[model samples]
Target: MGDIERALQTFHSMRVSAIMPPIFSMPIVAEDSPIVDVLKLLKTRHHVWVVNNKDEMRLEGLIRYMDVMNVLLPPEHTKARLGNISSLFKSILGGAEKASDVMERNVLVIEEDATVLDALKKMKRYKVQILAIVDENGRLVGEVSLRMLIDEFLRLMKLGGAQWTQHGSSSRSESH
Candidate 1:
């Protein structure tokens, strides 16, 4: 009936397809891609990169920031010490020599038709900040970030607040 109510309804019905923004970076590769290259792609562009093993780009898995960080920071006394930039570089170069070595095969993805609330819940449950928005064909279309959600929510709040102020002023004038 009012702006706030309309906003709430819109939020409840918003599908990932409608709210998801364009994909930031698509660093995709086959199974045999070098891990070092993948790491470079992730570092320079995306926090997560998708991988496909078959002919079709089926949702295989995601490589995350933590995975790359782990390779960069190896266990103590293995060969090199921590805090050494050279050692860190060597470790990353050594371990992630191959993409399969460092890639996180377990990836979480969301469908286009899923509600924004569903995406929020999934992100909260996984403690992740971003989710890949995919279609039924398993093709990545866009992404949804927490910042985007917060911005949209704040915009709705402002709209609702303005509507309430106008309604209050009108009611006061009528009473007078």
Candidate 2:
């Protein structure tokens, strides 16, 4: 079988827990945090941080690279724009915002026990590059990237078309 075939097979046979990359780290900020602060965090982080009210690590949403880029783009340059400086000031102040204001809340998520195929399907369906791995309790555990999946798929192909095996099963854990 080929890499895609093997990956598909693995997705059918194993759970996401088996092949997910070990959690490196995740940056987080409160839901009502100032956009400036979130921007600062994004500047020195891997992925967008997530947070809820009370400054808790709820992983309620994500701010991807594109999200930041969208924010950085001048409003006049895009169809989505604030009508006046007052609106822009409100956006910068974070007072006129909600967690849903700047977050990709409708994110694709998969369980740790879900098959790799599940992740792949979700990615394809959503046309996204990343999937948030959540546990049974609905807590964010880690993220799975398309790059990680491709690497694993390549490794499987190198196994001389052998049955897919998990490279590692360690859970990528994170804390607030």
Clashes of each: 2, 2
Which tens-of-lDDT digit does each residue in 143-171 have in candidate 1?
Answer: 77788787776576565652446454311
With candidate 2 superimposed using the best TM-score fit, by how many Å does residue 67's alpha carbon deviate from the native?
1.6
**lDDT scores in order:** 0.65, 0.63
Q: For each candidate, what TM-score against the reference? A: 0.65, 0.65
Clashes of 1: 2
**Clash pairs, model 2 backbone:** 11-117, 27-49
lDDT of 2 at 38: 72
Pairs clashing in candidate 1? 35-98, 35-99
Question: lDDT score, residue 5, model 1?
Answer: 69
lDDT score, candidate 2, position 5 = 62
Displacement of the residue 11 alpha carbon in candidate 1, Å: 1.8
